[model samples]
Target chain A: MYTMKWIQQDLQQYVQAKAYVDTIIVPLIPFHFSDDASLEKDAFQREVLSVFMRELEKEFSGRILLSPDYHYLKSADKAEEVKRVRSWVEDSWAQPFHHIFFMTVDSSWKKFEQDMNGTLIWLPQIVTESMQFSERQSVVHSQVQQVGEFIRSYWEDDK
Target chain B: MSEDKRPVSRRQFLNYTLTGVGGFMAAGLMVSPLRMAIDPVLQKEAADGDLTNVQLAEGDITNEPQRIDWEIDQVDGWYESKVSKTAWVYKDDNGDIVALSPICKHLGCVVSWEGSEDYPDQFYCPCHDGRYYKDGMNVPGTPPTAGLDIYEHKIKNGMLFLGKAQPREEA
Candidate 1:
């Protein structure tokens, strides 16, 4: 089992070195906004992501891997948007880093599943309504532990 | 002939004192404007000869990007201003350390690393699609005309220190 204590320490270190990680992560966020809407949210997202990336680089150097954040798509949108996202990831993200992790949040999941091409990690929705705060914490702890374990196992197997 | 041979009369003494006071007043009146005019000239001369030495010890090089901020006194015509700038320091592929300026030369926009999906592992300028390779060369056919400026670097002890980025001299 992945220990929460270890994950927390690693995450703390990651946050401390946000600038380096953000150097790689900032340009990936979807930035389209309506003329009527304020760009504050998008700006904040960029700033936060920049900081996060910098910290990641500082903590993990080039060893830390990153995947694009899931882009939630609705049925109403055209296929072009989906294709653009995939192309962006491939041309921009994958070219730099060979491996990426993604979570699917689309309604059909078929398009995303196909586009992800086996690179997707299906994130199960945690039922927060039924769970207490402590339970939610435990769930998060377990999830991170699993992630760490998977990374370790993958590294070991590669060797 | 043996005793007092003081030659100044009272009128001559008064005239001398008044002339001295008048000269002092005149000089005081002219001082501010003269200082205002001469100050910039002196400052420019000082700025032209100004050179700051930065010390780098051997230990400062790590896997992380180091932020280094510095100021240089620059003279623009008659005005002397301290130009403040920063650089990100990191180790390149050859294991030799380098410092790259955060500022983009194209339209003075700031370039951040990994800014766009189209160009990964390179510094990006979001304003005009400007791109810089990892070694800080501006991508050809991009907005930037010149490569990213390289700071003067030296190693002392166990640390890395950087100086100002001057234009590349032809060897």
Candidate 2:
């Protein structure tokens, strides 16, 4: 539990450092919803995510950019959903984010690489029983460092 | 001597003994009700107690009440388990911090604030259509026997905190 807290704090600092370049893009998975649940029929998850984003917008204001939550659709339909989400971001969001953080059990690196235009940050499934109790501080620290490095390298080359 | 020991003396003796025993039993039975009546009178003197302060702060109106959910371990002889609980904190109009329990007094239903359009600015219990004013008073025609339980509070810095509530004094 203590290690988890330390890791969370470190992640917050890392995200804050990256905040200078772009708003943090966090893709929340609707894991609580069953696979059979119809996305269009059930708006609970969308409403909750909307409320969370609004609250975050209030807290961070102009200092950060938060893209609307993506990945509510299935893996087969993910490509289309990603495109739709990207368009929504371009139209609705004030600015584009530099880093895209994806939390998933499966490391679909190639799929995300092809879909997203920004730097891809893969987060290991942290909610599982094994990861929940394991010494995950170093593992999380390394992942954040890798993502941060990618962002720095990508944006610096762009400039 | 056997012939002289007749029915009259035996009946007289039996009557006196039965009366004595019945009187004793009657006095013993009356003790419980007597104690029940007198106990509250004696208890009233000690009931003038001090209110517990929950240590809230000034100017801390967050629009939404801060929810603190916790679990307490309980033991009953051999059995043990955790009991889940929650409390909501808000500031009253007088600037005094107040905490109201979510449990309704009527039938122990959970009452939520601003739940319906009819009572826009009050707590509403969906279970029985009961309503309470924001300050915790029960609506006169409502099913609740008493008002919402107002938890004890005190001011510290700028954050509102809470303590357990006592039953409201009867009107």
Candidate 3:
């Protein structure tokens, strides 16, 4: 059910079962090649966000379609980017996704959250590299659980 | 020394040479197919590494399904990483232990035991409202086309060891 790796056969399946798949998860990732200091942080966020997205997809694969990552420059203007982001959500409506979510670890996206068409979920970035392996896993696991609950709450709101 | 040096007739030479070459060709032909036939047994032994000890003891499982998490090392192409897996374990009416994979059959979402207030005593998937029975059978008219997967399990030393979850055929 993960749309991240789209094959023709899966696409056909999705098309046939389009009514059941109502949710879409769009991961917003920022890349920074401008400075050495910001580069490492951006890279870490990308990896962590990927892990989070993968887990979330696994949790809600039946009802959700994971979009190919939406990458933007780290230094880009959020106000200007809102238009493109909203356009992406609008395009997804062609597939008729009811609940579109933009998941990101970047806090700056919070400013334009209201401007975006879908729900803009901002998660705090975790510096997992320095943390112990098990500790980092536990942290990510708990966060994923919380996020799963949050998504469920949205579904509950509809009923 | 004299007997060893004796010159063989052309027929004897042909016989020995043909036998040596034929043996080499026959061995080369048979080895690959032989390995292919035995390969599954070898892989099964390797797959035994998948059996993991879930911390909960055999005595602790109740009628209510409990979620169990365990870490396993997964090697996916290049990256070797630790992946956490989950299973819902409980004792059935007949007092036999059962473990089910949470992944929904319709579109692969995770289902929770008695998740929805409306659907009591049933596993519910929040995604598309898929439902499964207590025995992991998919409820008809629900989103799920097949039943939930059942994990292969064994009890040793009073501890539960679970292997992979095998998917059930359409119900």
In order, candidate lDDTs are: 0.54, 0.53, 0.85
Which lDDT tens digits does candidate 1 get at residues B61-87? 555555565566778899998655567
What lDDT tens digits, residue by residue, belong to model 2 across residues B53-119?
Answer: 2343445455555544444455779999864444566666665556777676754545667755778
DockQ for model 2 equals 0.03
* Interface RMSD list for the candidates: 16.2, 20.5, 2.4
Q: Write model 3 residue lDDT over A7-112, tens digit each, in one string.
A: 5766676777788777888899998788997777679879989888887777877777788899999899998888999888888977677788999998999988
Error of 3 at A158 (Å): 3.7
Where model 1 places Cα greater than 4 Å from the true spot, the runs are A1-159, B1-58, B63-65, B73-80, B169-171
How would you encode candidate 3's per-residue C-alpha lDDT over B18-120 as one tens digit per residue? 9999999999999999999999999988777678998889999999999998988888999999877899999999999999998888877788999889999
True contacts kept of 1: 0.00
Which stretch of 10 consecutive residues in model 3 chain A shows the poorest summed lDDT? Answer: A1-10
Off by over 4 Å in 2: A1-159, B1-60, B63-67, B75-80, B155-161
- Docking quality category of candidate 1 according to DockQ thresholds: incorrect
Error of 1 at B163 (Å): 2.4
Query: Of the native A-B interface contacts, what share survives in model 2?
Result: 0.00
